[model samples]
Target: MIAKEFTNYIFKNNIIRFGEFRLKSGRLSPYFFNFGAFNSASKLSSLGEFYASTIIEKKIDFDVIFGPAYKGIPIALSTALSLNKKDYPDVPFSFNRKEIKQYGEGGQIIGSKIKGKRVLAVDDVLTSGKTIRNTKEIIESEGGILYAFLVALDREEKGLNTELSALEEAARECNVKIYSVANISNIIEYLNENYDKNHKFNKSVREYIEIHGSKK
Candidate 1:
């Protein structure tokens, strides 16, 4: 019920599209999660609140919020803001630059100092976990511990070389549990048990998972 609201909201807002989609892995996906559709200020704030609620619900602990360059920048800021509003006041957020700054008052990091802090890295999704692993290296290199990583979704597809999903590999490699608001499995279950059975969405998802998804 609570999770159904999330899937429905995503579909209603066009955040997740149901159709043929070509992923970077060169696989044709039945559905796609598009964070870019969350383009409005209100939507962004809501997204932040969702991520904060997931973090709180999971009871994941950390001292600082960090995001990798580019896509993760807003996620880190929004999560920090929402966490601040929801009993986590003074939680500092930071993001890395694409290129290290070598000039006056400059470095790679752009926000709260990370040394000695337990950092929670936030991002949109877990595709390969390569970016997350690199982020972990960056944080640990500076004396910060990467306590956990949170993504908006986990596709539940297997890793390139193993039956474990990308999230599983990332968790294993980073030695930290990864959390997500709603994964593809949740969507599939919600659709099958609820919503209109006549619609093709649930059936399509079932086929996709059967062909490509791995055990979560």
Candidate 2:
């Protein structure tokens, strides 16, 4: 999708917001994004297309995509399906189980061959990055080669220190890059381009970025 279309799609659907809210990471956020609200196949299909566009834009290279348990499962499936529709049918997708199922697949991972394949982990948001880190460990234990991770948003806030967030740490530890469809900076830029009081939120986001977004 084009930039205009992508931005309108997200904004029109209320995927992004500005307000006081408690985040899952326990930080007070001025905005919140919930792509999980996309419930229909059509919405999911379109969202996946955007995700594919972002991945292509970043030139992320990976043979397969792995989504962690629960939320990541559908995102990965939809992204894979979108890529498939674009004639990139060779890309395979997989997801993990929250609990080891006693029947059928019998393991934490399901769909496609994960072992030894260079995989890109997909998820909705990169908050603390703990989820992605754990997922990476699981994939590695299964012999999957983690290439990188792609998420819908990057909070751009520090994780463990005023310098780095958990996502960055994960990238450092895994020796891979972390790409996002948009980030705190992007959001601020978007707002600055479209709204009034831009400096206020921009400064706020920057403060968070400086305080919690780097690894020092």
Candidate 3:
């Protein structure tokens, strides 16, 4: 399956590591997904292909791809390139700047103009959902309709207050659907199937999800 393959790829590349890690939300997680590990050209190209395949598999429709500042910039560009290779030639991607450029083009947004277009925001993961909401606001302010969101992984954990997962809450609050290439469950399952069935880390991950995971 694609999810299994994607999980395997991340594991092989050491993007996902099993350990006790403090998340941005201050919760101690049993594992970590470091998207930044996909730094090399080949790794980034493969990551882009995975994201593009997910977008196509989900039938996500959008006139432009929007990536948030920093980490999202390369993802947006690579996804567009991968889509182009997958028969989606002419795919346009846009990204925002942390600070308004005062020279040259002098704009907050770079690449395609999102105004009056169906925009899909792509990112690495959904944690607090704050970033995705902020992206939505930027899109709306620019006259763009946020059609949906795409992420590499869904942690499947509850929001700060709600019983809904972060992804679910973001989709509800933003009024846009969110899709992921894989979720925590897929990773755990892949590990159990491919690695030792009684691995201590796998057991810990299962317990962690039991305590914090959202209802399917």
| Highest TM-score against the true fold, candidate | 3
Order the numbered candidates by TM-score, best leading. Answer: 3, 1, 2
Off by over 4 Å in 3: none
Model 3: which residue pairs collide? none
- Kindly report which residue stretches of model 2 are placed more than 4 angstroms away from their true locations once superposed: 1-5, 198-216
Tens-digit per-residue lDDT, 1-216, candidate 2: 344566567677888866677876788776778776687888898889978888777788998899997888888988888888777747889888788889875877888888889999988888887877788788998899888898887776676543566666778877878887766666666666766654665556656555556553
Residue-level lDDT of model 1, residues 68-111, one tens digit each, is 98888999988888988987768898889888889986888999
For all predicted structures, in order, the TM-scores are 0.92, 0.86, 0.96
lDDT of 1 at 136: 92
**Candidate 1, which ten residues in sequence have the lowest lDDT sum?**
1-10
State the lDDT of candidate 3 residue by residue for 57-114, as single tens digits.
8899999999998888999999999999988858989999998899999988999999
The global C-alpha lDDT for each of the candidates, from Candidate 1 onward, is 0.84, 0.77, 0.89
For candidate 3, which ten residues in a row score worst on lDDT? Answer: 189-198
Q: Extract clashing residue pairs from model 2.
A: 157-212, 157-213, 158-212, 158-213, 159-165, 162-211, 163-214, 163-215, 164-214, 164-215
